[model samples]
Target chain A: MSKIIEIKKLRKVYGDGVELVALDDVDLTIEEGEVLSIVGPSGSGKSTLLNMIGLLDTPSNGEIWLKGQNISKASSKERARLRNKELGFIFQYHHLLPEFSAVENVMMPLLIAGVEKKEARHRAITLLEEVGLGDQLNNKPNQLSGGQNQRVAVARALAGHPSIVIGDEPTGNLDSKSSDMIYELLRKLNREMNQTFILVTHDMDMAEKTDRILRLVDGKIVCEMLRDGDKFVTRDLCKLDK
Target chain B: MLELFVAMKHIRTRKRQTVLAVGAVGLAVAIIIVFRSLMNGSFETFFDIFFELAPHVLVLPKEGEEYIYLYKTLIEFIWAIPGVAAVSPALSTTATLSFEDNVENVDMTGVVPAELNKVTSIGDKYMIEGDLYAIQSGRRVALGDKMIEKLEVQMGEDVVASFPDANTMNLVVAGVFRTGVEEWDQAAFVSLETAQEFLGDGDVITYINIQIEDPYQADEVAAEISALGYDAESWRTMFPQFEESLAFETFSNNLILVLVLLIASFGIANVMNMLVLEKTREVGMLMAMGTNQSQIRRIFLIESGILGLAGGIFGTAFGYLVSAYFNSLQYTVNAPTAPQPIVIKFLVDPFDLIAFSLLALILSMIAGVYPAHKASKLDPVVALRG
Candidate 1:
């Protein structure tokens, strides 16, 4: 599989005088059409790794190669352009602007990229329909249910056709039914469009469903697994002792 | 353009704040227009003092130069000049008109019947029980409107005017003349021959009041008159104090305008700054959406300019209404000289309106600069989080 996002010796540090590492010499490679999930408890750097993938936070010591460019040292304007045109983000909270209707909120990314308004609106409507939000396109975020708002956020993130969709707890605020719906939507989009997805979630049950899983503890990945065909396995599952 | 449109939406959403901003701009424009109008009034007053007090130019007796008695010779010579409008000679004297129980001081002007209407317009507006042309036609004296009240003399009744040269003469009350101005309304006008007769000078005159075809040409005519050995003075030369007063008014008005401009600019600055602070998150979103810094700044600039233009238009309309109402009101001064209120017309010149609009716009734009810059400099990451 071709790598869509590549990271090498990635390090993330917080605070000034005495720096604390959120990511310690981490290396990652996410391939096209891969549904990858980063699972960890609190303070396990799952969010920091997700942020680095989305280009929202910079690496302290590493190079991030996206598609074919070394984008780690890109100027702020260049980074903003790339973010607008090539990246989409979904946070733990469905951050749809309260003032805009679902379709308008979805159109934000397209409008920010200087797309014509009519075209952006057209695309946003189609995307809302794809996300089962056709009836709620004109409804504001406050008027929509938790599941509907999250669906709008998903539509917004996909509006610009970004190569990689990174979600930090996209279903963290939803009920179990809404979470199931979001997880199915993410998996279905990954299969239909063959787009890369990197999600950070605390729910291990949801994490176990992705094609690949990276479990971290104390800012370091302790185990990495890849589902083969339709089987779920760990390093011990394929051992002769099993 | 989208940023500006969104910014406009934001401004419109908060109507109360928008009104405050526009009101500040309106107040500034109002003050500017009023001061401009008052400045114009000051200019008109100055021009009047000059036109009424002095002719365009003055021809005077060169020091120790006696008029080689050129009234007849000079009149024929000056009337032939292309610029000379009309030339009249008058014998002037100080006298007191006394009735049965009243007496008042007067500058008695002995004017020729042909030149009486040409020298001053005060004679045209004022009339007592008798008529001016009737008085000038017969052997009658015209008393000023002020003298009529003081002397308590009736038309067709005779009064005794005693001249400084000791000639006491009995002249019938001809008419009363009033022009509002104290100087013209207080002076008595009579036939020049009658005045010369009263002053005991049959031919000698006090001075000549010359009117050129165009008051603008008065200077040239006066110069020529001086060459003929006579003294000529324009209205401005006569009353230097009124000119000084007009100049003082101009200076003070300019000072007030500067202060008001500063205050107006400050109001705009304060409002824009608050707007920037309040809308930081929106600004970040715009920046993240690929809006450049300069473009973001233009959004706020348009907002400020719109406010200024609207306020200016409102202020101008308001000023016109206020001035029109003020002008229509009868202002009673009850000045002992002219008892009735003189109608003052407040003229609104176009340049005054244009200047006021331009000044408010410039000040508002200046006020917008700092806040716009701050908004443009905002970082999308930090600002969005904030």
Candidate 2:
């Protein structure tokens, strides 16, 4: 498969007064239609790498590419536009706007992409159907359960039909049964719709099940593994003992 | 437009706060409108007194430092002017009257009994206790209301009137008259011939009261009379000091208008600032959705503008209602110079409403500028972080 996202010699530092390196000399290439996982302990720089690829944060040096576009040098607005059209992001907290309904939250990415209201609604409904929560579309985040709201957030991240999805512990707030369901859904979409997945998680058995896994420790890639089928947030929710 | 609806929804949701802000604006507008109206109404009402109760033009003695017993030439000259309504000649002098040692100083005016009807109707209304024809017959004289009260005398009571020439003559109380003024109500009206004889002017009159077609033409008539070498004065000229008082009231009213607008501007600014603060995250969300800075600014400007415009319209109506309420208060006042009602009447101009509304909207728009700029400057990444 051809590489769809490339990160070359990327480094991210925090603080102006005292330097803290969140990502250090990281180089990565994610192929088209690939399902990849970056797994590590709590402070192992996996989430920071995910942020750099998602364009939610810029690397201090080096270049990152998304599809055919060089996105490392994109302006803040350009980054927003790219995120709206070419990528989908799901975070552990479900980050659905508390003021909006589940469907409206799902429609957000399409709206951000400048899709017309009706068209955005239609696509949001379709994505919600894909996530198996079509009946819950009108409910707000507060009105819905944990697993339900996370599914809605997942539906939102997929609404614009982006080629790639990046999830940072997307099911961290969910029960084991819900985590299994979410992992199954992501795998199904990855295989059927040819969507690429780059997820950061602490799930060891789940990482061993993915098509590729890069393990990190103390701001460095310590190991890598290649496998198939599924990966879930935190391997403790996995079927490893089964 | 959609954004405005959303903002309005937020405002409506916070009913108490919105009402307080709107009430502030409404109260300011109402007070301003009523003040301007009452000032205008009183000003108009005050001028009407001169036209209705006093002469529009007066032709007086033209000679230097001499009393005018007769200004026949000036009276005839003014009577021929195009807008002249009627002219009556008059002579007046002060004399003391006594009924058994009760002496009252009386102002005696000599006027043609028939022509004087056009100026006032005191002679027609009063009764003569001696005889109906006594005043015209020159056999008896009239007594004032206050004089009767002081002298404790009935009509037909024998009275002695003494003039400046040491002439004390016996007469009967012919009648009593009232002219709605304390001073005029006390004055005695005798036939011009009788008064001329009493003052010893010998058929010459002192001044002429020339009624003009319109009260506004009083100044022009007075100027024409002046050109003819007569010292002509209009009612307005007679009340220069009164007019000066009214002018001061107008200045104070304008000062109050400034104070209200300044305070109302602060209210509008505060509301707009709150709106901008509340919508910060929403604005950031919109910016991340690829909306430009101008679109974000337009949303806020349009939002505050709607608030301002609605406030202005309601405030103007509120002002009108307050003025109308003032108009309803019609108790009469008895001022020493010119009596009036205890209440103020409402009067307004459409121009005043339009000007005040525009001023309010401009203030609201000015208040929106900084907040709008702040919203537009938000960066998407930092905004979307949470």
Q: Which has the greatest DockQ?
A: 1
lDDT of 2 by residue, A1-242 (tens): 88899889888888999988878888778999988888878878887888788776788988999887788999866776777777887777776666578887777666655677788889888888888888888887899999988888778777888888888887777888988888888889889889999888776655565788787776666666655334333332233322
User: What is each candidate's DockQ, to 2 decimals?
Assistant: 0.22, 0.17
Query: Where does model 2 sit among the CAPRI classes?
Result: incorrect
The digit string of per-residue lDDT tens for model 1 on B1-386 reads 45555556656766777788778777777766765765675476445434443344444444574422446666688679896655666666788888897888788877764554555434454454566666555457887666777787777888888956657888888777666566766777778667767877556665666666666566667667666556666645565676578678778987788688668768778888898898776566555444557777887887777667666777777766665565566333434544344444465777767777777777788888999889888876566555
- In candidate 2, what are the lDDT values of residues B1-386, reduced to their tens digit? 33554455556665765776667666777778888888888787765554444676777887683566446656667778888877878778887877786888888776765556555434454343433345776746666677677776678777777866835666667777544567765777667777766766475877888776676688988998788677889877887776688789888888889688768867767876776676566565555334556666776677566666667778889998887777877645666654333345678878888888777777767777787777777764455543
Off by over 4 Å in 1: A43-59, A215-223, A231-242, B23-121, B124-173, B178-186, B190-338, B342-379
Clashing pairs in 2: A203-A235, B68-B206, B69-B204, B69-B205, B69-B206, B70-B205, B333-B340, B333-B341
Local error of candidate 2 at residue A219 (angstroms): 4.5
C-alpha RMSD values across all candidates: 6.4, 8.1
Summed backbone clashes in each candidate are 10, 8
Name the lDDT value of residue A238 in candidate 2.
31
> TM-score for each prediction?
0.72, 0.63
Model 2 error, position A119 (Å): 3.4
